[model samples]
Structures are given as C-alpha cells and as structure tokens.
Target: MPHAIKLYVRYVDAINRRIGRVVMYMIFAMMGILLYSSITKTFFLPSLWTLETAQFFMVGYFILGGAYSLQLGAHVRMDLLYGSWRDSTKAWVDLFTVLFLIFYLCILLYGGYSSTEYAIQYGERSYSSWRPYMAPIKIIMCIGIFLMLLQAIAEFFKDIAKLRGSEL
Candidate 1:
C-alpha cells in the first residue's frame, strides 16, 4: 500500500512538472503574440482576435498551472510567523496546513466536478466571441484540484516522516 501511494505521488509530481513546463511555454507564446499584435497595430492594422486570443491563453495557463504551482511550493505565503518556528514545530504546522489544504481541495474537487458535469450536459459555451467549449476549461479546474489533493496527501505523509525524525 505504501509503495502504491509512493508511485501515485511520483506520478502526480511528474504530471505537475510537465504541466508547469507547458505553462511556461504558453506564457512565452502569449507574450510573443501580444508583442507581435502590438507592433502590427502600431505599424499597420491590428489583428481582430490577437488580443482576445492572448487573454484566453493567459486564463487557461493560470488555471491549468495552479496545481503545478502548489506542488512546487511556489504559491504565495504569509509565513512570517511560520518562518520563526523550530524544525519540529514547523513540521507539525506543515502537517496541519497540508491537512487543511487536502480538505479544501476535496471540496473544490466535488464542486468542480458538479460544475463540469452541468456544463457538459448543457453544452455550455464561453461568452466570448470565440465561444470555445468552456466545459473543458471548467474540467481542468477539477483536474487541478485533484492534483492539489494528491500533493497535499504526499506532503502530509512527508511531514509525518519528518515528525518521526526520518527523511522521506
């Protein structure tokens, strides 16, 4: 069971890393497109959809990459108090935080699942002119939450190992 859990954690970590890389590429692509659009607009005529497309990509990149950020511990933190704690105390605090995150992610996963299901059932489309299938994007929210949940679980066990004075 422990081996299986480890394998699952590794798989989630791999997926998170891959998604993070994709998000980086998407960001660069969006920047390039934005710059090109600005140049074209300044010199000749601007493309009608370039700015709008860039906005869409930005939204997708942020939403999809949320889990990757969480996994990498890159998310913002107000750790002034936490930063002063001893190693053992910090480990316990981290364990508690991971448990809290897991609980939150579980709720998000449930809500996102229902939202995605409803969107799919109704064939919901975005309000934008492009009218992209919003369901897929909504579904990505569920996936992100699930990934976060997995990472939280992993962190919980890692903290437990730390509390036991053992390296994970």
Candidate 2:
C-alpha cells in the first residue's frame, strides 16, 4: 500500500512537471506576439487582438504553472512562523492548511462552472475590435484549477506519509 501511494504521488508530480515545462513555451510565444503587436501598431496598422491574446498567454503561464510552483515549495509563505517549524510539524501544518485549500478549490470549481457555462451558452466574446470567444479561456482556467486541486491532494498525501515516516 505504501508503494502504491508512493507511485501515485510521483505520477502526480510528474504530470505537473511535464505540463509546466510545455506550458512555459508559451512565454516565448507571448513575447513574439507582443513584439509583433508593437511593431504593427508603431509602424503599420495596430492589431487589436494581439495585446489581449498576450494577456491570455500570461494568464495561462501563471495558472498552468501553479502546480509546478507548489511542487517546488516556491509559493510564498510566512517564513517567520512556518520556517522555524520542524519537518514533522511542518507536515502537520501543511496537512491542516490543505483543508482550506480544498475549500477554496471547491468554491472556484463551482463558480467557474457556471461562468463557463454562461460563456458557452451565450457565445461570449471580448468587447474589443477583434472579439475572441471567451469559452476556450474559461475552459482552460477550469482545467488549470482541476490540476491544481489534484496537486493539492498529492501534497496532502505526501504530508500524511511524512507523518507516518514513509515519506514519498
């Protein structure tokens, strides 16, 4: 059972890591898109969609990369209080904190579903000159949220295993 749990945790970590690496390529794409937008607006004709498309890529970068950040312990925390703790104590604290994380994810998933549904049903689009459909971005946001929630479960499992001294 320990071995199975360990494998599961590693699988979850691997999934996030791989996706995070792939999503990072969007940074280069965003830069190129922004540069093209700037050149067009400055020299030729302004492409209205380019800037907003770049913003969506930025959102994707932050949202899709969230699990990798959490996996690396890169998320900001109160070091003054959390840093002084022992490993075992930290694991315990993390386990408790995950409850709040779970609550937050639940709310996001619930609220996001309705928003996504509305966007799809009404064929929502941006108010810009080059109106892009909102459904795809909302769908991607939901996927990112789900992946983050999965990562939180993986973390909670790791914390539980830590307390048992069979750290994954």
Each model's TM-score?
0.82, 0.94
Measured by TM-score, the strongest candidate is: 2
Evaluate residue 97 in candidate 2 and report its C-alpha lDDT on the 0 to 100 scale: 98
Cα-based lDDT for every prediction: 0.79, 0.90
Residue-level lDDT tens digits of model 1 in 70-118: 7777888778887788989988888888878888888888898999999
**Model 2: which residue pairs collide?**
none
In model 1, the runs with Cα more than 4 Å from the true position are 43-48
Q: Which runs in model 2 stand beyond 4 Å of their true positions?
A: 1-4
TM-score, prediction 2: 0.94
